[model samples]
Target: MFQYFRDSNNSKNQVSEFILMGFPGIHSWQHWLSLPLALFYLLAISANILILIIIKQEATLHQPMYYFLGILAVVDMGLTTTIIPKILSVLWFRAKTISLPECFAQMYAIHCFLTMESGIFVCMGIDRYVAVCHPLRYSSIITESFVIKATVFMTLRNSLSTMAVPVLAAQRHYCSQNQVQHFLCSNPAVTRLSCDDRKINNIYELVLAWTITGGDLGLIILSYALILHSVLKLNSAEAASKALSTCSSHLILILFFYSVVVVLSITHSASKTIPLIPVLVNVLHSVIPPALNPIVYALKNKELRQSLYKVLKMNIKKT
Candidate 1:
């Protein structure tokens, strides 16, 4: 069934779109299932957008670390935005189909934001490294120019990284098997239906997945290693305690964020029979972090707490 239906080749037809069987078995309480997801979606996006606004308007958040935090917040929101709305539609609206190009765009956007987020986290770690390891030179070193360069490089790198995926995917043919396992279109899902030899595409996906995603994750880990080393060398107990506290917050976030993605990847790879309540599992990776991030930052970082409270006061006044 996976053959191109050119005029010359009438016997074979390509699959132009995919059917997403998102959460099939939740027949009993679809409304109950969808309601909480909608609420979480709204809460996550709103919280992240709020943090972005406060970071932009509040001049005190202009440091290299906070600059990366603000960008990461935006990326987090974008990532959730890409995934959650589609899930909501399937759960709440009973819409489950995505056109071929829409699928590719959604996949690409999710990967882009994922790449951007990984880079930003590593960048923030570097900021901490410099701040702690080279305290005397930190001021002169982490200029706005440096931050811009890092961010721009990350953008270009991530955008360039996945350019081959859709192009390669287009070369293959599908014989109209519209059923997809999950809610949204994913790389392996789209490629699996192709008539052409997907060895190259599969290889490319591995390269991008491991090299880009895994490689970026590696850098983040290394950055933290160095930061930890530097933190440990502190002579004073109070100084070490403070450094450890800062490290703890970041470690909590990193573990949660990456753990979700890794688990999702593993589940997606393994599950031949995509269960019902599938949208809910996807929600774990998308909505939870954005919803939890502001809370983490507010509770852990003094600066964000003060800024958050001030922003609340400003909103109260405006109302």
Candidate 2:
């Protein structure tokens, strides 16, 4: 419902709902863009579900790294599902109106999942580090208890840390503007629409980004550096190659995830010059990694590949 009010001196209306402008420069071809976006969303959901199933069914696949992977699959699905359907609705059906509560919920989910994903990556990096650098201690250090604890801790940390983002946004008085430039209810996009000052919101988000994402990335880098050093010290080239091979899938996923994030951040800064680019990149960020993570792991991990084939064959026979 659209709400309006007139003050003593100035006329202003409280924004009850926000209109999502999906893409600025490509309205003519925006409907066509929905096809690929829908495909990516479908792929992300199915592939991540498949990964979760394979991990659960295969007894041999139950380990710390795989457990972390199962968690990643869940996070990836959540990350994509939070924003894609609404985006597709905006694209295909031209359903752009979102209520304030729905907008806040979407914003909270997006930030929480994003932070969780980064935390999971950091945990996965630690798993790789321990496995490679101290093979003998890997089992004792990266146990199931450790995985459970890490997952719980990160979930709590990310949830609490990101809760304030939407809370802060919701508290603001949206007196005039209600059209959000981006497809989703992002913090920056939503907060920018507020008539009130958002300096506190901006500053808190900046510190939170650095504290969570930046901290996670730094930990991941440090783990990889140690893993690399340990691998280089191995006596046999074959051993070193094998050691590095185990980390290839992880490394690739990390690169793809963080590289897109970096590019998206840059595009956001230059959004004035390249508005459409940021929107496209942001959409891709939601879809691509989730769609590709399962494929990459299946391709790189022989055990996972074989398990997937077995699962597929079993399903085929049943059908």
Candidate 3:
């Protein structure tokens, strides 16, 4: 199956398209599974769009934190949209063939948005750290202009760094198997298909994964640690409780994001026995969070709850 070049006479022949298996173990029921997957895609896209609309319309939400949240909502939508639509096409329509250029495009988008999301989380951590640890300085520290600059910095940093991945992967010689194991154009999944020497690609991916994702995670931990320390310093139990409560939603989102990611990594490594687990997790990691993030924020945030309630009330009155 890993035959790209025909022979000495046709050595220049190379793969220009790939087939996505789209859940091999349960291939028979893949169509049935598409129902929930399609719904999840709808939910994620709608929820993120709603969040953006609410943030944009509500002047009260024009703060640094909300700005970061808006960026995160955009990232979430991008992340899921990059993978889920292609998945639905495969599962529902049996459109599994994707050209190499299109595959590389998807790969770059997935990496860019995931990294940007991680960076946005770190910004949120900083916002919370300032709000909880230094309430007085929060206003001065996290201004609208500051948030814009941070957004730009995060976008450029992730986009420029991740640009190399698709470029490098596209340059490789794909000689044999043109079928991707996962639903999406994942870095390693696509790279493993190449017949060229992939040592540099693998090493580069590892270094960036650790440096970018690991570094962002470390900063998030440190921000929360300081937040906890500050909360403990509060003399009144009620004040400490309030501070901790404010962080609960953020911590939940962070936990969910990282936990799924870690599970996906583990499943990929241990996929020798249960090969289906990694593929499923890879798809889930993209959609589940985007679908649930807005709900999480609305439930835990008083301002957001009020804004949503107001929007609903106005819509009902119009009807």
Candidate 4:
């Protein structure tokens, strides 16, 4: 809905900078927080990279689930990379400014990764459902060609989807306000900074959530429902138990991921009225979940657990 307000000369409307309001903490505590945040970022990157390496080298992991996990790792890397380093700079060096292009890049990267992660989760859910429901056909159902095509579709859709945000934002004149309440350029945050008509940006923001986040969540839930239904049909307790275990971890992850996004959406929309709470929720959305996701998945999955150890051993040996 937003269009870029270009000067009549069609030259760049030069907006030099943006202000970031980082978390509220004591000065000493902010530095301390940087230590932990940096550690978490390192861990996230290392763990996700480890997962990717293991999946690539281990023939056993050349399956649909691990393939989706690989995709998740990539998305995790992109999302964390987009937001965390800038946050670290603010916390560590007291630099809390971003240029307009950098702001747009961050927004695009964050939303692109987010959309991919959501779509990847849905694909993962579908894999699990098929594996549990029609084990006999699981192989054929999620084949190499199928995976390739699905990956292509998701990559294209995700890459193209968030573009609307910047496009919409481009329509608005940004001379009046330039302070972002939080770290990084999120759609709503940047939209708020625009001085021109924000209706288009706002509309696209809502539409993006519904179509990308909401749509992905809907598919995930539907996949899980089918999986649960199929699991119920298994006559053997062992079969049912195995199926339940396979899905339980996914269910937990799906719940957490979807919850964060939905809460962020609602909280942000409400921030116009209830300010502090929404900001807190946004921080939770950006930080806690990314830090926790790999940890939880690695902890719960036997393969990932073993792969992590293998990764650690390799690193130690190299060092």
Name the top lDDT candidate. 2
- For model 3, the stretches where C-alpha displacement exceeds 4 angstroms are 1-13
Model 4 lDDT tens row, 165-275: 766665556675667777667777777876666887788778888988888888888888888788888899898898888876677778888888777777787877765
lDDT of 1 by residue, 71-112 (tens): 888888898889888888877777888766677777778778
Which regions of candidate 2 are displaced past 4 Å?
1-13
Clashes of each: 3, 0, 4, 5
Model 2 vs. true fold: TM: 0.94
* TM-scores of the models, in the order given: 0.89, 0.94, 0.94, 0.89
Candidate 4, residue 277: how far the Cα is off, in Å: 3.6
RMSD, one per candidate, in order:
3.8, 3.7, 3.9, 3.2
Winner on TM-score between 1 and 3 is: 3
lDDT of 2 by residue, 92-167 (tens): 7899999887888888888999889999999999999999999899999999999999999999999999888877
The model with the greater lDDT, 2 or 3, is 2
Candidate 1 deviant stretches above 4 angstroms: 1-13, 24-31, 273-280
Question: Distance (Å) between predicted and true CA of 54, model 4?
Answer: 2.0
lDDT for position 144 in model 1: 90
